[model samples]
Target: MSTVVIAPELQKFLEVVRAELSDLDAEEQREITDGLVADLTDLIDDQGIEALGDPVAYAAELRQAAGLVSARKQVRERVAVGIRVHAVLDAAKARCRHVLEGLPGDVDELLTSLQPAWWVVRAYIAVQSVLLSSGGWSLSPVPDDSISGALALLVVVAASVQLGRGRLWPLTRWSGSALLRVVVLAINLIAIGLVPAVAGGFENREWDNYDAGYSDGMNEATGAYAVDDAGGTLFASGLPVGNIYPYDAAGNPLVGIQLFDQHGNPIQVKGKNECVYEGPEEVLTDTSRVFFPWSDGAAQRWNVFPLPSRIQGADVAEPDPTAFTGTNRPAVSGFPFVAVPKVSLPGLLTSAATTPPKAFVPGARTEDVNLVESGC
Candidate 1:
């Protein structure tokens, strides 16, 4: 039987434990090291590398279990400090909100300006929830560019509304009523101005650089080849069809070929415009392209094309004389030709030249195509 090796990080942790335990009774240290090794090995065998959350944490836990007082105290102090910091931030936020409630004029605008401050508190609460909810602590979720842009837009709006109201309130109380209206209108316009820019920012952050790769398809007649769910593998004759080539609409050899599935679906195959006698040397190189069932996102779908194949004993220029015609010529004059000789071959091979696989023929009704989520 083969032995599975422990990861280097785990091995180093064991070494550190061994060093720390050296001050103990010789036999006791050996026994502790052996037990720790056995426990770690079992953990690796069962749960894999995920058994260790963090190397330092793992080491600290092991030290505590082995009765190392100093290490245990250090870990406890770190945890206590973190808890206290979170508590202080939470109290500060509560105080700020209470103060906001007593202030006058457009509470919504004031709240909007104070959102950033509230988020700090909200993030702290979220972390606390994670800690108390049996999952332990987790960091605040990273805001995407879209979220950041939205927040920025909100801030601008809040500032504009506050400034406009402050400027117009005094003017409206005086004789300059028209000037006050103009200020109010200007504030609204400036707030509206953020809409298009916010929309553009949303588009840029979400979709600007995204390029969904090709779709997959398969030969209708021959169901011998297909791609994986992610279209990374090319199965030919129940195996990977190693040779892949892309062609343009004019049938010229291009860089990458679009492959199809058994259901005549086109799949995407990524490649550069370079010719190699060998087949696809890289399969599933990018994590984004890999087909993980858990993450069935849009990027997983592929578009594939058919690669070139060799015709046995046939020259490129000549027609395949082996093709069965309806009428066979008699060997001699007046000799009867075999009547309707059976051709023991695969599906009907039409005399028509090879071409790209047919595109998907969508059903007449939108429901048939399963456009709605209810149908799917």
Candidate 2:
């Protein structure tokens, strides 16, 4: 038989097949390599070597097919992960929407009562700014919460303006209709009451005390003391203590004293001494500086003690001792005591009772107290 010369292109293809089969068993490698050579030769004869396309392209296609199987498996795994992530995100979005929609009708009712005005404008701006900054735009395919909040705020502003203009209870065009007027007035009253109740509930539910002292009591040599609007004690001497330490409203801590009761209750003593430097020691030098002190004293000592007589009355909590700090400052300042009403008393009692007591000893299992005593 005449010797048949292999084309340069066919030689190249065989070389690639040989390299790929190098890692296979000798028998398998020979079988695969020979098969590849024969197939390429037949392809070249059927279509000119050039027409069969680039040798590298053909080799690349084979490599890609082999890798494609592995790649497809990887793609399936990635798709599964993506699906799970999407499902979780979808559930979260639905829950968020439900929460926003479940807001009390009073939220909308209050908005309806508000009269459109500059404060309303400011309120809308504030609400929108909050929503936008909180990722309102990307919340979901539809921004349900952002839209609802905006609409609710708008209604409130409109109602406020109407109430301010005395248009809330307009005299009907029908003359001598006292019955109509009375009915309208009653409806308006009910609506007005509902607005605040709903808004109040929403605020109370969401507003959490940021300071540890506010939520839990501070431990001292004597015992655990509750924090009030005033703050916590800093030193063992009963000086007004703050986490940031001794900074007044102006960021300056004058002469201060901290003391602890025998039971480990921390007491804060502030303000400069009088002419004799022996006058009555004041608890706070300024009203803003006065905080609730936790003690084992009677309920009256607590801020929420003493229920008020009327529901519409002011809170009967103790006034801050540091409220006024000028020349007329009292020798010992404390919050003005107020009466607590049933509505306020129930909440106060519930909070106090539910709150766990602080631990007396350090490293104890107490949930309420985090004593960072100095020199301990």
Candidate 3:
């Protein structure tokens, strides 16, 4: 018996199919793989190879045809889900290419067949070109109103003219049409490259937001440093409160040194005028903490000065920075007397005798101080 040599590509393809059908039991897998090797070993032609299409896709088809159960349901589910997702996307892509191909004749024919309707089609092509070249559609719903749009329109119109005159798509006797085509090609290439860039930008933005929150939380849990007015060190909450800025007389940003509170906590400064101060840990409630009727606002102190109007503020009481703690006290719900539990009323409401001021200190008066001036 003569030994039959299998093509390397065929071998590789067979291996991939085997790997994809890993869901089948070991015995079934062996049978399928052996049958595939035997059948493919006999044939070696582009037609035979092309007939298989993608190895992965072929494996899925074979599995379905054989009614073979997957060894791992999770793997099968993932693959099936991926196939479902790609089906619509791939179909849409094919549809777009078909549409582009269906458009009227090449440059030379387009010039000769220039009709009122053809011009409208040309305009649509121009708009689409601008949109693709600029990547405006990727970033926003509306097209960017810029020079890129103008350039895209210009290139498409020129290409259309060349195509109308019965010449090549981009080259009209090596004239402006050729240059315009190059530009259009460049724009398309750049836009395609920018797909990853735009995606990366979004990813980076999300990461930055997450990192900032994490850092703020960590800082709040730990303590921060600052200096007092008398230049003494003091312990303070690690949480950032606000910023401060100091500049030279010439208005240049001064760096190198950081400011501290009277407590000796080191103040963090970024750029020239920007400063970050430490404060209390933040508080969050599952429900809105606001009682609109009684509270003019909630967490009003969170509003940093010299900035835009803040909608909400920080915690009213300083939070325990070391760890997250829950209160045993039942949350006070609803408004005033209606929501208050009658059993807890006495404990909830402070006694009037203890609540009122012992001595009503009216307005400030010089007579109260009884200051005497030295005879001058």
Candidate 4:
């Protein structure tokens, strides 16, 4: 005959009772819970889990039957919650176990083996709670940049593992004092409840960094990075280069530059680029500024670099459909940079004679090439 082991659910049920009776002496508590594991397993198998009912109520009845319920024990530090709340929880727990027990596999041992993993998770939740309270939590599971952070994390997790294994101080004995046990259980419950909120904080922080990492470099000290959402426009790094600016090797800002792709197709930017111009006002003493986009006349050439802007009171028409007659604000070219440091262009790559690149025919298919006649 196979030896019977106590189910994990039953063990959890007994743990709750043990916690409730934390005020009692170890010897008496042991007398109550000791050999009942096998007995209750048989009992539950015989009459279904309903036979055991609520573990809290059963503990109370057992204490009363054994004459262990003293007046002082009745009102003891059970301030955690009353019997009814515990009974409801016990019933819910039993229902969950019933559902799991019905599943067609060895779920009992599967859960039993996974208990250590929960220890690590609970420890992380505890550490995150502390960091969150300080209002500086980071997205990384281990957020410290130095060795101290790693050491602190190790200490916390090791303590938690020890606590879970019942190898720590008071629990190393039969149990700790009632007040200490109650406080520990309350802390664990708080950690469990904080999982969703902690996860949300990390997710929000991740997206914030992603969005800010790609915006205009004016707000950030760092240069702009290219983003994937530039809509077929010119991008430097990852940011959309709204208008192109070029510099000669001597660092002088060059104008009227045009760009093309590897296929010799003109590279055009699809989005609008608004340019601001400042000029002396005629009627007022203060200078004025105008917001208008300059273009290469009616042709609307976007591939041209350093597109110019018009001044406040120039002869150019107000930015509208008719404003594209000719490039306006010719004298006031509003290039973002006057000069930029030059960079060396890389040398052109040459293909190996043995492994030439594949020839690309614009619109020709394999069948079209096959049907073509060679030189006569």
For TM-score, the strongest prediction is 4
**215: Cα error in model 4, Å:** 4.7
Ranking by TM-score: 4, 3, 1, 2
Compute the lDDT for candidate 3. 0.44
Q: How many steric overlaps are in each model, in order? A: 33, 48, 29, 6
Q: Write the per-residue lDDT of candidate 4 for residues 249-307, one digit (tens) a residue.
A: 65555555677889987666553423232222222212122323335656666566654
lDDT of 2 by residue, 221-292 (tens): 434443445443234334432322211223222112344568876444322111111124422212121123
* Superposed Cα deviation of residue 125, candidate 4 (Å): 1.2
> Candidate 2: TM-score?
0.18
Candidate 3 ranges with C-alpha deviation above 4 Å: 1-176, 224-376
> Cα RMSDs of all predictions?
30.1, 25.0, 24.3, 24.5
RMSD of 1: 30.1
Which runs of model 1 end up more than 4 angstroms from their true locations?
1-147, 167-177, 183-304, 309-376
Candidate 4 wrongly placed segments (more than 4 Å): 1-95, 171-185, 215-376
Name the best candidate (by lDDT). Answer: 4
Weakest lDDT window of 10 consecutive positions for candidate 4? 367-376
47-145, model 3: which lDDT tens digit per residue? 566555688887887887777766576667866866665565568657866766677756444544554345434544446544555643232212244
lDDT of 2: 0.41
Among residues 3 or more apart in sequence or in different chains, the pairs in candidate 4 whose N, CA or C atoms overlap within 3 Å are 225-238, 225-239, 226-237, 226-238, 226-239, 227-238
